[model samples]
Target: MTATESARPGKRGGTGRGTGTGAEAPRLAGVPLLGSLLDLTSDSLGTYLRARGEHGDVVRITAGPPGLRTELHCVFSAEGVQQVLASQAANFRKDNAVYQEVRDSFGNGLLTSQDEDYLRQRRLVQPLFTKRRVDGYAGAVAAETASTLAGWDRAPDGVVDVSDAMMELALRAVARILFGTDVDTTVDVVDRCFPVITRYVLRRGYSPANFPRSWPTPGNRRAAAALDELYGVCDEIIARRRRDLAATGATGATGSGTDTDTGATTAAAAGTAPGAVTAPGAAPGEDLLSLLAAATSADDAEFDDTELREQVLIFLLAGHETTATSLSFSLHLLARHPELQDRARAEIAAVLGGRTPGAADLDRLPYLTQVLKEAMRLYPAAPVMGRRSVDAAEIDGHAVPAGADVILAPWVTHRHPRYWPDPERFDPDRFTPEAEAARPRYAWFPFGGGPRACIGQHFSMLESVIALAMILREYTFEAVDTEIAVSAGITLTTTGPARCRIRRVDA
Candidate 1:
């Protein structure tokens, strides 16, 4: 029963055990040794749905090592999500064991850190998403999209894997803006370790305990090797920039890779900035790396080079993968629904009018925005968010022991029929401002909620819109086959691969 409904003093001893709801109380079966394990591992959403249906919204099921009870509440209810995220947020902490399982490779950047460290880092990094700062990123987003589109082959009946296409676009966009490097060149450098990282993070059997480091699993070894290479690359770039800036006598980490006399280029790599660069109309450039390097915490906390690399690596891994999944799934939906695709394309064309999309265009492209929102609702990359109670407390009148894990799942919430109409269908209109207003605040969270909300949210959303607009403006896509099944691993992606046919559209 909801906490509010059961707040009255109970006449009986030790508070009432009776369910506030008129329905019979759920009974835990003594049999089925593997029931909870199977439920936790496979088809977790389905299991939650059934439990909610059988009992009420806040049903408890047997989970974890046998007899080790854990509270599995369905906060899909708007009120439930709010209470969990905002009302009692301080009571929650990111589920460490689960996050550690995923974040061990990336190190404790924003995504995995908690308490004072997380807050300090968040404060240092928050300004980068400010209107003035994000506005600066628009030109880069557009340039990357336009350049990526120029290389597309749209032959008659030519098929392209939209998912793969988006992966390429997002990785490159993030790389250029965040690290100031041509991502296309670095994709090979980083992607060599991508599969292994993904496997370790998402694989059901991924337990750090049993998996011996001695074993030469190629992916694991590759991932370790890749980390070394990534660190080396980051160090090299920092040293080069530091050297150039010193040569020019620049106060901060500014660029000096150019000759003022002849406007002669010194750095030969294509797309690399000449010592320093500026945005299309801005005075000077400040990429994510530079900004992080420049930031100083309120308490005088400063990030050294190692900390900087850790956060940047976190940005690369978390930011790129999630945005790619969102775009990929949205494209898959667009291909399936021709009417929706046409509507999105028309919206983009009308708003952009053949000129490149700008920050202003984002505000105008409501339909495109809705399409992305709905797509992310259906396929939230980080579907489940959890926290462990530091001290023993009652949650919705249930005694949640201090060590217990409290989970709030966006996947189940987005698909909760009570809130989402036709929960499983690909319906973009549901995300209209009017429609969204009818739902609860936490009902549609894709970047999660509370103090720990994904820091790269604005960046990701901006990237998705620009990328989609660019692709739709240049190509008309159709689902070559609608039967392709999508499965969830680390990210909600096609079980096999996302295949689509594209033809260049006439401007």
Candidate 2:
């Protein structure tokens, strides 16, 4: 929830458990020893969809051998998801193995930190993502997107792998925002190093036997090398930022990577500013990195050097990858559906013809917003969210054991027949304000809910809306390589190219 929303749980049911009398979740059949390992490792989306189709809302999936199996209690019902994420959130913890891998690689920052650590980090970092501050970064997003469109215009035959393009676009945009004046130092995260580290985390996190990361195995060694390079780069940038602030005798850890502090500071790449980057809608501040460096908790506590590095790492990792997935898939969906594309573009033209989009225009382009929401519902970035049950609980009348690894999958829940009619159809109207209001809160949660929801919610929406508006206005897209495969990584990533042919409206 945003800082503006009330923390009160809306209305409560008698038991809040669904229409059953509390029995163990039905299991999907699997091989004797291996269980569902092959199915999951090969096609996680298909497996989850099939399980939800065969078994009802909650299904227990056991994978691996007898001695070391991984059991996942999948909750695909919107009500059950609400119970896990919002109502009984305290009963579900982020103590899963994959999260541990995140802590090891990125340090115990907000993404991997639990309970009090998470609360403290949230207290210190929440202000940076306030609506006003993030809206201010729309200029930076526009600037970066302009460069991307230029590249697309210059591409041979006007053909491009939009998946790859968006990955580059999102990485550069987020990097520039994260380390404003020193953005060039963040190049390592964009191209070479970060992928290796994430791949290693995915592999080791899912392996039945997670050998110690310190082992001399080839994967571990390679991962270690990548981690060192990433940590060193972040540390260098943070240290330099602190030094610059100290040298200049400035207060609040070098005001947001650029000029004055009152507005969202013309914060872009190290040198994208040519004017006062005024964010006309909300309150304003500097770039997130500087704000993070300068922030103090309620008790006057501040993040230490290492702590600062951890927060920056989490920001970069989470912010960049997830937003890219949303943009890439949105473009893909719009490309394939020309009727929907025109409808959205018509709304965009009506609202923001010549002027660039700002946070204020968000409410004006309702169709475009629905299109984006529909894309997110189809392919949520974090498809399967893992949480361990803190105590034995009854969900949808299913008895969940304590310490069980539970999953809340937006990929499945967004498509639940109960909540979503014509589940496979890509209908933007499903997200119309009225329709959304009629559904359960968790029915279409692209960004997970409750207090632990993504703190970067406003920032993500700001960046995505600005980029999508500009791109849709500038060019028309045709799906070139129409079909693609997807898999679950740190986020949902395309395993193959999603190529699109561009027809620039101006050219």
Instruction: Encode model 1's per-residue lDDT on 282-364: one tens digit a residue.
Output: 21224566556655544645577777777877777777778888888888889999899999998887776666665556677
Error of 1 at 138 (Å): 1.7
Error of 2 at 237 (Å): 0.8
Off by over 4 Å in 1: 1-31, 63-74, 154-157, 182-185, 203-222, 241-285, 396-399
lDDT per residue for candidate 2 within 1-507, as digits (tens), equals 111110100111012232233787899899989888789888887898999999989998877776677778888898898888898899888777777777788788877788777877777776666665666677777777877887776788988888888888888788777777556668655467888988877776777666787789998998888888888888887887677656665445222222223345334212123333332222222456666777774464778899999998887778887888888989999999999998988888888766767667677778887887888899888888877776778887788877777887888888898888898788999988899999988988877888688878777877888789889988999998777788877788789889999998777
Winning model by lDDT:
2
Candidate 2 regions off by >4 Å?
1-21, 253-262, 265-285, 298-300
The lDDT of each candidate is 0.62, 0.75
TM-score of 1: 0.82
